[model samples]
Target: MRIRSNTGKIASVLIVVLSLLVTIPVAYAGDADALAATLSSGDRADADKVRDAGRKPAEVVTFLGVASGMTVIDLIAASGYYTEVLSVAVGEKGKVYAQNGAFVLKMREGANKNDNKELHRMTKAQAVKSVTDAGFEIVAEGEMLRNSEDDRAAYVFAEGMRGNTDRFVLKSRKP
Candidate 1:
């Protein structure tokens, strides 16, 4: 009877120790609050308003499965609006490519040059800087659709209302 009791106590202690070991990794993985705070700080005022108005950055980030060490591509990242937010979500080990189509340059070249120029001015370097400032290395700029599949981004944020609505489309490797 004493032997059985001793064995039961050892099993209980083992279970408790095993549970603590399992939970420690999950606790240390990431802090959502810290990430959110970083996002709110670097984000623009209007973008914050837009985020507050309808979109939830944290939710969107989670839905996209963004982690600490993944690469993302922002399609037609106008004015680096979502770039700032994505940089914060992906963290230091992650990267973001803020791409623009040729249409942006072409449109900026003609009659609407003044307005388009301002748009490009705000978006160009700032987009790259945002990720770099967040401790990510920025890749070369250009269109994403033209890139090879391996060089392609893991996630794509398509701006405007035409494609994929307001949500980001995520691409994952098949197991």
Candidate 2:
């Protein structure tokens, strides 16, 4: 009887421990999904297709040296493609700055004359909200082609014509 009682107690403790382990991972996965959703709403199918075709967001972010709580500045954040991913990777403690060029906004305005301005405005607004929602704050805005002496960006990510190979330039502040 004593041995049987001890075995029963051990089984009950094991069940409780197993239940906790399962629950923890599920909660973490749910949070990750929520963060991903907040970053991009575009047909993930399309993003996946694009990523598969060339560079993936995960790879790009890794190349950019984006660490949690570090500040990242994204240049020419047209349509917030990379902005969403950066926000999620940075988590709640980090910051992501989405900057766009005047030429890009003007081009967007020219392409869709009817709603270009509205769309451009909406894009910037949404990009800001996307990062903020993912727990990041916007630090500054500027053009990618133009260099600012005091930009002090921990890392700068940009989309070039070719692909992800040369699309990013990582910069560190001088001590």
Candidate 3:
């Protein structure tokens, strides 16, 4: 989905990783060199390239163990920086979904600028429960995306919060 929010750089980094592997021909999966190439490729915007050093998207993807032919979903993908990275990581065979909440987009419009009631975010416990309730077994939780400096109270899209907010990677398996 497309997002029109005035979300800053932090929104560019808000990624919720959900991965599922499948057998498919992936040319560049799990290759560090390939990831680096993707990052430096001329096709990418210079603005995105400037942030690569700090965001460490490659390291975070590797830490999450994402590989070729893995279906991945990136939630709150504002500038779609991670989405592009993940798309290349997954290769031609995999699928990547970049999602931005409707509420967030709507809130940015002039008509609903003050409509805070429509904004709903799940707590960590609630997020876990929602997945467990859906019959998926929790397999693992990845902490590579965690930032110790974040006080956990700042708005996720707040300035200076880029790559500094608590993010959970819930790996689950079906019975």
Candidate 4:
């Protein structure tokens, strides 16, 4: 897909798809807290809700610095699991490109008729590295903290550790 240039920004903001939390930033900490509740909300289907234990959608979005009104590319969006959560996170103004892989398409052909595995096939690790290498700075290190919201936040973090998971966030460096 051809991305049109917006204000000549060098593809700075990275919306990572960890399939996975931030604790460091005081301001954004509340983001993780609030979003975790949304992820675990009754709004989600029972089948999808139960998977939160393993997927940790809230934490992943927070760590990746996702917000409302930003276009996100949900690479390898299997069964559109992350895609659903991202849609909520990005709100109506934002858009999510839920691109899945060929293997995923074949496995779940009924999922989407336009399935093309080659569409956005980069691995999560590669995505992280590419963003960082492109001069994207990690402005914060996310950790789910303890508080009244600890239970929900912890549910999002799920034994938080820096290197314990694949989630990441980065921003473009100013030239």
Winning candidate number (lDDT) = 3
When superposed on Cα atoms, how far off is each prediction in RMSD?
A: 23.1, 22.8, 5.9, 11.8
Residues 5-63 of candidate 4 have per-residue lDDT tens digits of 22112111224323112112222222866777877774878888876764566775766
lDDT of 4 at 72: 68
- lDDT of each residue in 44-156, candidate 1, tens digit only: 68546455334455544543445555666665555665666666665667676776555533433233322222221223244444444545443223231122322222222
Per-candidate local distance difference test: 0.40, 0.39, 0.61, 0.50
**Ranking of models by lDDT:** 3, 4, 1, 2
The CA lDDT at 113 in model 2 is 29
lDDT of residue 22 for candidate 1:
18
User: lDDT tens string, model 3, 1-175?
Assistant: 2333334322322433344443353555455666777778848888888877657677667655666787878777666888898887787778888888775455543643443221222345655676667777666776656566766666655687755565555566667
lDDT of 3 at 127: 57
* Best model per TM-score: 3
* Candidate 1 Cα lDDT to native: 0.40
Tens-digit per-residue lDDT, 1-175, candidate 2: 1111122122212211211111111112224334444434544556544553344454434433454555565555667666666656666676677776665455432343232222212233444454455554444332222223423222222344323221212222212
Count of clashing residue pairs in every prediction: 0, 0, 0, 7
Structural RMSD, model 3: 5.9
Runs off by more than 4 Å, candidate 2: 1-53, 108-175
Q: Name the runs in model 3 displaced over 4 angstroms.
A: 1-17, 21-34, 53-55, 69-79, 93-105, 108-123
Clashing pairs in 3: none
Error of 3 at 10 (Å): 16
Pick the winner on TM-score between candidates 2 and 3.
3
